[model samples]
Target: MADIERHDYDVIVIGAGGAGLRAAIEARSRGLRTAVVCKSLFGKAHTVMAEGGIAASMGNVNSRDNWQVHYRDTMRGGKFLNNWRMAELHAKEAPQRVWELETYGALFDRTPEGKISQRNFGGHEYPRLAHVGDRTGLELIRTLQQKIVSLQQEDHAEHGDYEARLRVYPECTVTELLLDEGRIAGAFAYWRENGRFLRLEAPTVVLATGGIGKSFKVTSNSWEYTGDGHALALRAGANLIDMEFVQFHPTGMVYPPSVKGILVTESVRGDGGVLRDAEGRRFMFDYVPEVFKGSYADSEQEADGWYSDPDNNRRPPELLPRDEVARAINSEVKEGRGSPHGGVYLDVASRLPAEEIARRLPSMHHQFKELADVDITAESMEVGPTCHYVMGGVEVDPDTAASGVAGLFAAGEAAGGMHGSNRLGGNSLGDLLVFGKRAGAGAAEYVAGLGARPEVSQADVEAAEQRALRPFEESGSAAAQHPYALHGELQQVMNELVGIIRRGEEMSSALDELAELKDRAGHMAVFEGNRQFNPAWHLTLDVANMLLVSECVARAALRRTESRGGHTRDDHPGMDATWRRRQLVCEHRDGAVTVTERTHPPMRRDLLELFDITELRKYFTADELGEVTAEL
Candidate 1:
């Protein structure tokens, strides 16, 4: 490691998405030498692709909306499987984080009273998202990038060069995390542009990488999301929780094969769009479960009226949590009520004027017009489910965002247990912001407390280097298998078998397929021998990560027999009391995955008091309910 090209930093933040950028900001602010390393360009992380807004209890639209209500909504959205403390912190700290972003040059859509505008989304009792129309994520990334540049400018003026403290290494892929005595020492990465391997030695590493969406064929995620951080954390000896809870966003573009599976932001429905079958029937009312009783409208008229007067009527059934809506759409298509493209119809044209639709959802309007040749303002657009996010990730502490491994921290989508089995729409942005700063601050505090830096041995470096160069060795031979072909196979397997709805036999078959793919992935090779920006070489590493992650997803899904938020089993259609109280944790040991069930600890007495007896009875066993009530 010392002989190779090596650099030193106090902290190295991996995955420059919203959480990574935010973490880098916090670490730099604390005067720690920080480096932000990302697989893509600084501004192109999945955070920029987020079309929906940021969830925060700003209370601008509904004064009664507070952290307490937001907390309850989030807990309900996750079906009470969420970590109550994380929900509490996210709800309480989100508003301040959003407001802080505004100071860093973020502009939000303003309300009539000149406050940050709020909008309604599924599972929220009140309008809670503070956003900039439908392009909130773009604005968020722009603001964070601008802040990074501003910091660099300040550092240059104070010192001689910009690299003295904070620097960004874009187009770099971290292949392996270097460890010293089972703790994080640094990470080994390659420059995506030149294929040159490099190492960064740091005492602390923060993982802000996003989800495993691209493992499935129909996904809103970009090519960068192959679960690198998830796999990296596991290999670094950190546990991954709730690996089966993959989120299929309800409204992905379902028409025009070229534009298939692209996300249609939830802002459309928030602005008064309706979901209908081929018969123009609003069908979500039939799918509401007893747990969400009295939370949504029962009639079309009541639902429509509630948009204008929310206090008087319940929310529309079309605005149910993503899981409920996704399942209903699946049922509608299965029942032969689907639209022309095997999707349900989403009609904003009938609800809002052409100009209003264009202004509120400019990206979606243009996306459909340019890609699908459909005018969202004039006709209903066809939409169905697509793999959008994974609620599961590396398990971390709520307050500090620390994984069990020392000097290793995870935040944003990379860290698990915030959303539980399902995530509420717009909660993604909020989770990244709240935990990103915490992870960064935690890393800084951790580095300060360390007595000495961990040592990196040459044996670890040489082994990693040999593994990375395997593509070049296998490229020229006739036995070579193209990495792209292997990637396509992985995506197809994830989509067809372990997709939206699950069955025991199908997932078991997927696990078997994944095992073979893992062996084949090791034999993958690049087309060109050269390392400079070789797409095939990149896929070699990506396919391995995707294969490992796919195994975790499939194995965990098979183990969870009961139907819960994202890990739904067709055979077990209802939530079972036995499985509801536990989560499956995955670890890579002895070249095989080892999974174990861990019971959720009891929530603090204060947070438990937020739920009523009725809600408690739904999730807990009689003995558990008795303990909760006794605490109350």
Candidate 2:
């Protein structure tokens, strides 16, 4: 018999992303026995793929920048549908967190004045993203990994539960939630290295498993982002909020069909790049506001002038918000002014000096050379939108990061309502840090006060046990479906029907196709041996999670009629006032999914004084306005 191991912990964190690792560190510091689990290699858990910098109010580049301004910008960038409390907390805490990373030895790019360098990103009013060249994510992860590794030798005797100390398990995939009396008791998972089944018994569990980018065909996110937390929370009876707001980044490379749409970072634009048609026409100015109408210029002189006088012209050639840029690219392609790939040209070479482009965007240059065989310094990149981030996830309070399910909590991209309908390019890193700490501290506190985990019934274990073994019993090899093929089909369905723009018929048909994919998953057969390091076996599990969560997205999209933020519906072109009233919330009941609308609480009274009355009046009316926003 394969050895079954029982690992006891005060809290089990089911991811190793920036959020997950950060949570584990905090939980350990709080005297809780913590275990950080992941399904990929250490330092490569999708977080390393983040190219743009983290958004924080460091006020290094501009002394005028403050938490209040950052908060306002974040709310505005999210189209004012954000959880005001989360935005407030994130804005206030992010600067401190980023500095803490520096203390832990993260090497951020610095300004000539010796402070951390900041850059402009889509939707930010000013330079806000604190970066390290173009590979901010790598620096962040490496810094955290070093910190956690250093802490591994620390004594946990003060906690009185030494066995519950923080430990990391790489290449482990969580299979099911072990609920006791409808409360989170623990979880069961498989280790990819030895193909061993391990049981984690904990009173509190934090799901920071990141976003579900793998659900779509083209995404900037890594393969590990298969919506594991979303599926796990739904199965455990936790409610997911705002599943309809999926953000498609408007600059994925469209070539070679193999890597159909790889993400091209927004920093290229932030550093004075320009978007143009195949005929080299600057197109964004035609569709933008009158204030920004004469912004971009073909010559270097006018373009340089806009940088100094944004009020007189557009902000900058590369400083447009993602929504505006995405629509601009769409119009270009629609009007037959697109490249051979049906995408527009994103040219940074014409504006920035060659030396600066190579130094600031070395990774961009390297990737194109190795993958696409194009030199970005001399040629324009073909770009279009690809599904990148999800604004919706398991609903939780901003203060606690605790889900509706008692023992379950979430953070990072898996947690909902922080970014609302659309997240700014660099805000996600801040969201990870701010909420990751909250979830860890909260989970630790919860576990610290609780008694041992409740009983794990035989039936619960048997259900998961049966599911794991079902693939092995199939007699015919031909009947078994390959995991990659299913994943491909899922991505195609999602990209075609539920893309940046959506229609009622497309969404409805997508739902039908999702049902069929789920059915196909039931009969999937893995011809590869179910041994250690079986990438296919893990792909199978990931596909199941992706299917479950993608269905949640399609169903939620169907219920939301109006076009708001990232969830645009072609059938309903206008943003309805009713959309501002609530968010779409979903929960799995019995064997099916159920979605409902819930009130999006207003800004809390304690913080209402911070917002100027003029801005409040501009957004909300006298009757619709309220004094207190509920934390729940």
Candidate 3:
């Protein structure tokens, strides 16, 4: 035992993003001693990178907007594969969550009448996103960070102590979930700065770690999002649902290889940007699917007209959901309609006024000007799809946000079922707020009812410590595989084989390649002796998680032989009828990953009635519709 330090808390929240902050805040309100552990500095967690806004049907811009409409739009955007209960709760609670942030001192852009401004986003039926220009997420993090400090002030006042009841462990990475028998007891973690081991003994654990985007070669996610929470939950015997659905956002800067996968916020289109091909043709008009046919404009004239008139004209095709736009961009590039940099052109110059573009999307303007040396007000910028988010993660109960394992709660991008097969724009931020609070409240309730504090086994702690040091020991071996090489190989494998387009043969080949990569990762090593801020050593651990998540993604993609939401099969083509009723879930079996299928949970009677029966026929079968109606 390498002198591992141990601490105790009522709850240990892994990850310090928007979800973790909200969950910790709620946990503290229940009088629980909580600890937050993250791989980065507190507020810098990926939530700060969110640019667009938070989706909430406040109806500020459109009076007809409400939760029911939001719910319908979410279901439709997800291809009706969403957990209706989760969607219902998310749609119903998001508005209040947004309003609650204001109470925490989050300022939003104001309308002419002085209410929080709402903006249009892809797949939303109305202007329903509560925003702060293009930096809504910055306001969110600043507010949550301040609220956490205020809570600590109150706690210290009550206890007459310097440190509050809640604690934060920054620049730490959790390696294992310490389980007592079958339930979560604590977690084994290590600091990134010095590689010292830590044992967090807590009865309840909340996983709010974000997503798996870092597994791809080109991604919008940061280094921390290597599917840590997903891999940790799987190792702890929790099921990962819908692992195949990866969201590839349509607009990423394609030039300047150094900044290739940087996110181009969808706010560009929501604020009236257009997607044009090499020949100056607006290409999205030819790609709208039947599900969103009437909602998008059919011609350039109609698309231009829709910017000013809200009720009569339909939305421009540029504002279609990300899945549609990503695929359209992929197809256009493949057919040689791409820009000089192998991406489509995003033209705000042809749509919005220069002053309006700079006022609304200063980040996008600055990003292009600083990175690519292209003035967004003067010319169209090259953009392409980049791996952005994963819609799959630990499956949780709709109401409680509890995983299948007791005392294990998940929310935000770490948890699945809310978005189903795909997530619409702005829903991710709302998810962080809505479910973050619920997971906190749920974990607090579960803790109050527990018999006693669970104990962490000494043997497990020793094993974790030993494993953490294995890379340093193996660094001198002849067969020592460089962690960076292995990591790059993993990224290349995933991006080339199992990327945006999938096929049966390609996915099958990816499985065999992934197995070999997993073997190499098991023997991965780093450079001699440096432990402080050693990125190479850190990648050795992160690659393990990426390999596990990559296998799950490729396996699930192989199994689901249809196109729906974020998952599209090149061979099988369109959405298959039989596949529509099933949700692909993954588990770490005896020694390998095993995938299983389960029937999609049916929606409640009242919620089903909110959608038009004619539109219901798109997803459900006649018999399924009858079963749903019979319940009423």
Residue 406 Cα positional deviation in candidate 3, in Å, after optimal superposition: 1.2
In terms of lDDT, the poorest run of 10 residues in model 1 is 1-10
Every model's TM-score = 0.98, 0.93, 0.98
TM-score of 1: 0.98
Tens digit per residue, CA lDDT, model 2, 101-188: 9998999999999899988787776678999888998898999888887677555444444333778888888989899998888898
Model 3 residue 11 lDDT score: 89
RMSD of each: 1.3, 3.5, 1.4
Model 1, range 56-139, lDDT digits (tens) per residue?
998899889999999989988898788888999999999999999999999999998899999988888899988887889999
Q: Report lDDT (CA) for all predictions.
A: 0.90, 0.82, 0.90
Model 2, runs deviating above 4 Å: 155-164, 289-303, 306-314, 475-480, 605-622, 626-632
Candidate 3's residue-wise lDDT over 380-470, tens digit each?
A: 9899999999999999998999999889999999999899888999999999999999999999999999997778999988888888778
Q: RMSD (Cα, Å) of candidate 1?
A: 1.3
